[model samples]
Target: MKFLDQAKVYIKAGNGGPGCVSFRREKYIEFGGPDGGDGGKGGDVYAEAVEGLNTLIDYRYQQHIKAKAGVHGMGRDRTGAGGADAVIKVPAGTQIIDAETEEELADLTEIGQRVLLARGGNGGFGNTHFKSSTNQAPRHANPGQTGEERTLILRLKLIADAGLVGLPNAGKSTFLSAVSKARPKIGDYPFTTIHPGLGVVHVDGREFILADIPGLIEGAHEGAGLGDTFLGHIERCRVLLHLVDGTSEEPLEAYNTVRGELEAYENGLAEKPEIIALSKCDSLDEELEDLQAEPIERATGKDVARISAISGKGMIPLLRQIADAIEADKAAERGKDARPEPAWQP
Candidate 1:
């Protein structure tokens, strides 16, 4: 299936049914009263997050969604049937925003989560509601109210525990394929992986999701190369695995270029915990690998792991580090959610 992250759609709720005006008529009835029935309620519009879906491509063809209208009221004190509801099922981690104001209406992060996008109109009252001792022969009825309508924007962001970042052909896809079962397109050219891909990495009896997006180049934030459009896919990652090509002429410059784009994009990506690794270490000898990693280590103030995805060198250690970082982040989130007991109050 083709991946689609964003879509625009128009939604409308159902309209309520009108009331009926009638009077009872019999052969020998001396005092006959009004017996009009009330109208039925209209259908509602809802957006739900469901499983087995990862893209919004289905919304591309179907842009306008409308609910069913309620049935009209009947005479002889018989009410009309209510209309059926309309639901829009989307993938998890999808967000609904108002197209006009760009305000985020709802964020669905978990499966089975649902939100009411529009409410149906209320049913009108019948002539029997106006019947009283003074106005026994009421002949008036109210009309149904109109339904609500609006345009919305749907945006999807992939949820992952760790993300991979580097320059093109820096071995990000190779590392993902080696570590997990996800077999993304691998080639020697730039931008081999045009779209974002997810893999499940298992290390030391623990598993976590990993995301690999398209490579970034100089001025990527300014629409250079593939641009930073795919960067939003990794915004929810707890840690980043930054890979620097060991065979590149200037690895430090490549690393700095990607970092510049991340900082320029500025969505807390520059502040995320990162693990730097020199990829394709099998192509270089020990001395050459050390020489290539020295500048990046000095600039980042951290030790850089030498790894080769093809030969499986340093893969376990890298996976373990990513798992540890994910665990630490989860622990920190749990700590924040834990509320301390309050002191005794008067």
Candidate 2:
């Protein structure tokens, strides 16, 4: 199936039923009073998040959705029937936003989550409601209210525990394939990966999800190459694994280029915990690998790991480091949520 993360749709709720205006007539009765009934309510529009859906591609073909209108009221004090509701099913992690104002309406991160997009109109009142001592013979009735309409935007952001990022040909796909069962296309050319891919990584008898996104080039934030559109898939990751090509002539420049793009994106991605590694070390000698990692380590103020997916060198340590970082971040998040609320004060 084609992967679509964004979609635009229009929705409208049902209109309320109109009230009836009638007078009761009985045999041998000198005078008759009004006996009209109220109208039924309209149907509502709702958005529900469900599992087994990872893309918004379904909305691409269907753009407009509308609920059924309520039936009109009848004479003899008979009320109208209510309209049926319209429900939209979307994938988990889908966010609904206003198409024109870009205002966030709802965020569904879990399965079975639901939000009301548009409310139905209220039923109109009948002439019986207006009957009083001053006006015993009422003849007027209220009209049905109109339904609400809106244009919405649906954006999907994938949730994962770890994300792989770097420049083109930086061995991200190779690394992902080496660690998991996912088989992403690998080539020596740039932009081989046109979309984001997810994999399940098992380390230390524990499993966690990992994501690999398209590589970043210079001026990516300005729409240079593939842009940073795919970056949103990893915004929820706990940690990022940055793979710098060890065999590249200008390794430090390549490292800094990817880092610059991340900072420019400005989605708290730059501040996320990252583990820098010199990939494809099998092609480089021990002396050259040490020399290539020195500048990166000095600039980042942390030790740089060396790994070669082909030779399985440093594989254990790399997976261990990633797992450790993920566990630590999870712990910190739990602690933050467990913190007690401060005592209330004026």
Candidate 3:
């Protein structure tokens, strides 16, 4: 499926039915009073979050949504049928905003979460509604109201366990392909990855999702070199995989440059739980690996894991280490004081 993170749309609620303005015109019934019924309510428009979806591509083609209108009222004090409500299903983590004012409408975080956007108008009154004790034959009524319409924006942020970060051609795409089933375009040049890609890795009967974010460059926070656009996707990740290309002329410089961009864009991004990786180790000789990764580890105060994607050298150990770190982070997140009952107490 084509990935679409952000989209614009217009939604309209159904209008209410008009009130009835009929009178009893039967034989020998000259004293017929006002018999207009109340109008039906209009339909409402709601958006709900659902599972098994991670894109907003559907909204690109269909930018408008409208609810059913209510039925008109009838004579003999008969009310009209209410309009049918409209339900819209969207992917989780989709943020809704009002297009006119650019205000936030809703942030759909969990599955089945819903928010009503537009409300329909009330129905009009019939001529019989004006009947009074003094006036036996009333002849006045109100009309039905119109539904609400507004433009909205929907943007999706993919939730993941870990996110890959680096500069363009820093081997982030290569590393993800080697570890999981994702097939992102990889070349010897820069700016290859245009969007974020997700890969699922299973270890010990447990599956965790990882995201390969587009590479960052200097001044990325200021809209330079892919900007800080894809960084939002990593805000929810429990851990980050910061890859530094081992073949770079200055590996430590490459690491620090990306780190500066992260901190510039988001204050706490630099402080997130991260694992330092020295990619393309197979392309370098043993002596070069020492010069590339050891200095980087010392400079960044992180143990840089060296791995080769093509030859699969040291890939398993790297993945296992990542899984361990992830487990440890989750454990710490729950805190040590979290008490539980026996396993089979039930």
lDDT of each: 0.92, 0.91, 0.86
lDDT of 3 by residue, 155-266 (tens): 8888888889998998889888877899998887888998999999876666788899889999999999889988888887888988888889999889889999989987
Q: Report the C-alpha lDDT of model 2 over 3-65, residue by residue, as the tens digit.
A: 899999999999988888988888887778888877777899999999889899999999998
Task: Say which candidate scores most in lDDT.
Answer: 1
- Once fitted onto the true fold, the runs of candidate 2 whose alpha carbons sit more than 4 angstroms away are 25-32, 343-346
Residue-pair clashes per candidate: 0, 0, 3
Local lDDT at 237 for model 3: 84
Could you estimate the TM-score for every candidate?
A: 0.96, 0.92, 0.89
Could you tell me how far off, in angstroms, the CA of residue 151 lies in candidate 3 after the best superposition?
1.9
Superposed Cα deviation of residue 158, candidate 3 (Å):
0.8
After superposing candidate 1 on the true structure, give the runs of residues whose Cα lies further than 4 Å from its correct spot: 341-346
Choose 1 or 3, whichever is better by TM-score: 1
lDDT score at residue 245, model 1, on the 0-100 scale = 97
